[model samples]
Target: MTAQTTDPAAAARPRLRWLPRYDAPRLLAAQMSLIDQSFGIAMVGCSLAAIILAAGLMLSGDRPGALPWACAMVVACAIAYFGRLRLPGRLTEAGAARYAHGMTATLALIGALWGLVAWLYLDVRMPAVVICILSLIAGMSAAALAVFSACLPVAIAFFLPAIVPVWVVFLATGDVEYLPMFLGTPLYLCVLLVFARNYARVARQSIALRFENVELISQLREQTARAEAAQHAAEDASRAKSVFLASASHDLRQPLHAMGLFLVSLGRTGLDERQRQLLAHIEASSGAAREMLNSLLDFSKLEAGVVTPRARPFRLQPLLRKLENEFAPQAEARGLVYRTRDTTVTLHGDPTLVELVLRNLIANAIRYTQRGGVLVACRQRGARAAIEVWDTGIGIPAAQHRDIFREFHQLGNPERDQRKGLGLGLAIVDGLAHTMQTRVTLVSRPGRGSVFRFHMPQAWDAPEDTPRPLAAHSLDGLRVLVIDDDEAIRGAMSELLSAWRCECRTAESEEEALAALAAFTPGLVLADYRLRGHRTGQQALDAIRQQLGRHVPAIIITGDTAADRLRTAHATGTALLHKPVVPQELQAAIDTLLREAATQGKGAPDRQAAVAK
Candidate 1:
């Protein structure tokens, strides 16, 4: 009969819900698990209570079936406890509801059996017996509420059967003496029912909260994994890009080196005003390209550890004024103001490197800022001078504060516009800062602007070291040796050297240079680091020095930017110049090396002596 009534509805309709018939499988599973664990304890307790009640009845010698009733109830409870244990811990919604329904029916049967005491054994005329039976009925209802209240349907099911029979039996006695229990049974059931409904709602809510938290944590872990994967992939791609740039620059250096020399050579020849204007445009474009390559070379030099800072006391006013003059026109063209506050404060550092750092900072400030002005100022703090570059520009977030100093990192430049640069400005600035034993500090707020502060030690006792400006020193009748494997480069270099009125000879290999040495004892040797027959310029210089029995002044020019290559070339103890060298810089380097040779009493003693002075 129970199966016929409950099986169809169990499959078709949900018996448990926080709302109207909205079945929740997870919630049902939680409720069932709670009840399953405690059901056996509850049944054991019921069996014990039944035995106590039966013993009393037997001792009074009134109820003949008391011992048998206690035995029957205990047997039923043992069977139910074992059956409840067979139910699966994990359950489908329908299965959970059916479990609840089955438990409720089982509880009802036990409750009805207890109700039999009220029907057959109760006698209101016996006050002691009546009091004991009433107390047992109320206690059973209260226990059902406490143990099974997580599922409201089961609690109410056990409650109705146990209490209803007592009310019926007492009312039919036709005694006004039993009115209190008849009135009190419904009130007792009502209170327990309310408490059961409230406790079930709270338990369901708590379980749902736990499930939500677990789901959120799972999603957080998944997102974190994806973010880390993306970061690693981006880092790999950046490394690949750096290597490609280094290789491509190496290949283009030879041609660019030759081209720059030929352009200088061509400029010396006669040309009209219109032709001169066109030449200026070409030189301007070449200068821009060379600047980009030089940035990479500068980075390579730093990485190769070839650069050293010579700390000398120098005033900041001159450097700041020069930068102001150079960038003010640019700032004006951009419809923004540019200004500087001059300070006579002397700082002890390498002036050229300091200038380079300041120039990069100023350029970066001008590039990012669209609407507001940039200011360069200096302030004294204790024994240090703090030089600051302030810009009202698009600011960086606090999260990426340190990442901006990493190579090839840029924000808001996804298209990688060359005008915005190669993203190495701040990286170079940071590297130079570390080399100088200073930290470049930044203060920025998103959308407000930024300030970059650089500190230098102030010099008090040291004499001021002013910068020496480069002048056009004549290379007339200078003994110059130009050795290279490429014919075009050799020819172009010869023309450039001859136009400067220098006695220049060209060689293709070490053998050719050695053979030429018989007729021509050149003062200065210029060689390509990577020459024909796998011979490097360093090896050529070594061979030439071996033959001559003296240290002949030489310069090695090449485009390779590998740190290992730079370090290897630096090991030769010769002047090293990267390719695409402009005429002015090339002349300056040659003059500087020649002056050093004159001091050492080697290489064209008379002319080098004259150039040195």
Candidate 2:
């Protein structure tokens, strides 16, 4: 039978077999087990019944002493049950099986005694066939039950009582046919005993299989739990790394910014030609280090999913112009041509972020190309434009093309001149492109060149607006207020402004800034965010503004990467810049602030209403 399901009712159902309703091995084993438990309990009850029956038989003049033997057998069966329960399975199955092998002779002697008493004392006339059948049935039932109950001695004891009846009945009748058939009782009993053992084996195997399945399921659950825990730990470590990088980047940039600003100012003061050249080299090295750090920080932010793209409508041409100028010198120094193919078309959308992406791509193209030109081009594709950087450089291998976009993966080339970079350019480009909802692709051959392209959605229906020109400020005679905690940075910034022909008033603290304001009302105010002894540049600027009794133009330079810093700077209505500021960038910031102040002053008192008008 195919036992497919674990349902009890299904198990109990009948199956087809061209043999007995109960097969030899399985039927005998189950019967013996059932009988063993039932007979043990039944023996006591049967002893009482036998005593009563024998007593009643004696009162009716049938038998008198039969009750004693029946009662003794009952006592024996009870003892067997108790003993079997205590006996270990090792002895019953292994030792008992071996011990019972040659004990049939002793069983025959017991059977002879039982039969003699039944015949002589009871005087019960019994047919040879009935005697033979009864003896065999009783012998096999008792012996099988005893074996099932793990009582090998008791099982051997049953054989004697059962076979003796057949011998007695056969001798009494004096019939040859009856003698042969009656003597065959033990043989028939032994055959059934063998079948009973087979049933026990089948049941044991079924139970084992069930337990094995349960164990397998338990192991699988444990493995799955471990995998989940490992995954969570990996994620936690990644988050921690991002947090550490974010905090450390801000701290490192602060000192670098102070040093660069001081160096910029030092170059302006009475320096010999060689000293001036050395300072210029220092400034270039500083710029490169700052750029690499910024790239790493941006990549970390992108990986942490902290950067949010600020998409706004603006002209794209100015951004393109700025990138062209930025890479022109590098291209010239590398002896490679750099040109803008077509940037005449106007487009819109988060110009700052878009420019950052294009800058990295174009810079990488220029850096990698050995002898050929790098081109930045824009081509209209349907409603959007495809902006591409094409370089005839040592291209990426087919296997490594996609891998290069991952963080910190660099291509190897011994013969080519390679720029030392942080390997974050393409990673940042990929991240920013996704942020802008643009699709970027790379097409290249191993040794030829690479073309990196991305599509920018058109934000304007018409051509972009031309940039407004800024009027140059005459700083020659203007008084500038510089407030910073660092003495070197304050002095350097003062010198830099002085070179622009402005009279600079340097203050190292809020008290000094207030005192400076009392002496001279400055045209522009430049302050560092962090000041000495738990002070801030904002506090100093506020004091200076109050002393001047007017809205003095000011800008805040900071090395703080936290959003709170930017929020506080914006709330103070100050133009802000991150540190490691180049001289030209600082000047541009100052110029822009002054122009805004001029525009505001020439308009209505409500700045918003004036701009709207």
Candidate 3:
């Protein structure tokens, strides 16, 4: 023989040659592990077997051989049990085969001792002794098969020896009366071995499955940890993006806001044809910038969830008419027909919110449609009315129907043309629809046209009557107080206010503004939302009220679009305006706030609080 390998697995593997090698080393290691744990219980069983054998002999009056045999069996059990106790707790790859072989031999030796006693302790003439030895051997072998079945080779080694010697001793007697007992012993051995084979197969499969489950659980935990880490990183990135948008929006809007104020103010001055011509071009550019900024503001407001709808019963007919009037001229200029169907339907929702949603839809329809017309119509559907916007300019593809509603995702404008817009129109529409508890559904075809529709709950009951405002008063002698941290914005606002012939006072900080409240009582207050010294316009408004001892109509102009800031400004119940406010919008906000103030009697009513003396 050439040099043999020292690997114990190679040497011990042949013991399992009768069975297929299914991961032989690991399977052997698993068997050895089971044997190591359950060996003590198996030894306890051997001790009981020893007691029964000794007791059977004494009862048969054959005490001579009985004591000696019992002593030998007990000694065998002790050596097998004690030898395994000193081994390592877990089997090593190198030691698994070695330990498996050792356990097998030790168990086989105990079985051999039991078989030897059967031959020595048998007394054929004494039926009690003969019956006791055969019964004891059968029970011992069966017990061995149960405990060592995890290692099939060890179970077979222990089972065969513990049983076959009894049959051999009885057959040698050649007594025809015991013929059946000796002959049937071989058949019984065959049956028990079959059961041991089945148990070992089942146990092997169970052990393999248990290992697989442990491995799977480990992998699942690793994947879950990675997913959680990825989620946290995504959240951090989103927060960072929001912060960047907020600061960039504020920085860019400051100068743009001043430009609008100055442009409108300069337009009022008498200019030559050339000067006015240059101004108109500059004004056009400013208007486009204002549009984009407004889009951003609207998206931020909606994302912040601050645009709560003040729901009420409003006539849908008037809203439809207003949209038609506004978009008709724009669509006609584009050589597209803009039509609005007449309906006497009333809707139970905030009129402002409904108008906003319709306005964006109609604007998108008109903007996208170049040749064909745009149609705005309403259909009654049971308790709801479906308002539809149909356009025939450039139809959207079916694939893009969902994507078109995502913010900053535009179709047919890959170059991101500013005139085509910032791609926030549909997104804002979707958001507004969500607030109204409705979904906007789209049906479209490429190269054809698209129809966008959403249902509004129908107001079956007629709307309760509400007061309408009187014609807006002129800004002349309005006693306005303007507070802004930006110098250019404050100057531009004052010039614009002066042109409108209003008595306007400007303060750069909340402190300066609050001090100014001493000599003058302001009919209106205009403050910037973000200010120096960590103050806000709302704070200034509150201080102004505390100072004058009366409610004052205030407007908070802001360039910041942070969600928290937007919510805070909106919750103040003051008129909040975005920066880069042109003179037209600025005047409109002022007029609306002042008008509402007059209607509600909110202006500084009486500092005197006159007492009837």
Candidate 2: residue 247 Cα off by (Å): 5.7
- The TM-scores, one per candidate, come to 0.63, 0.59, 0.87
Model 2 misplacement above 4 A: 1-252, 270-273, 300-307, 312-322, 343-348, 379-381, 413-419, 472-484, 497-554, 561-574, 597-613
> What lDDT is obtained when candidate 3 is compared to the true structure?
0.81
Clashing pairs in 3: 257-580, 369-393
lDDT of 3 by residue, 165-233 (tens): 888887899889888888898888888888888988998899899889988999999998999999999
Candidate 2 residue lDDT tens string, 429-507: 9998998888679999877999999988766566445567766655678678888877767766776777888888888
Off by over 4 Å in 1: 1-22, 51-64, 88-90, 117-137, 211-258, 261-281, 296-314, 321-342, 348-353, 361-377, 381-613
What lDDT score belongs to each candidate, Candidate 1 first? Answer: 0.81, 0.65, 0.81
Badly placed stretches (over 4 Å) of model 3 are 1-39, 64-86, 91-99, 175-180, 465-467, 515-521, 543-552, 596-613
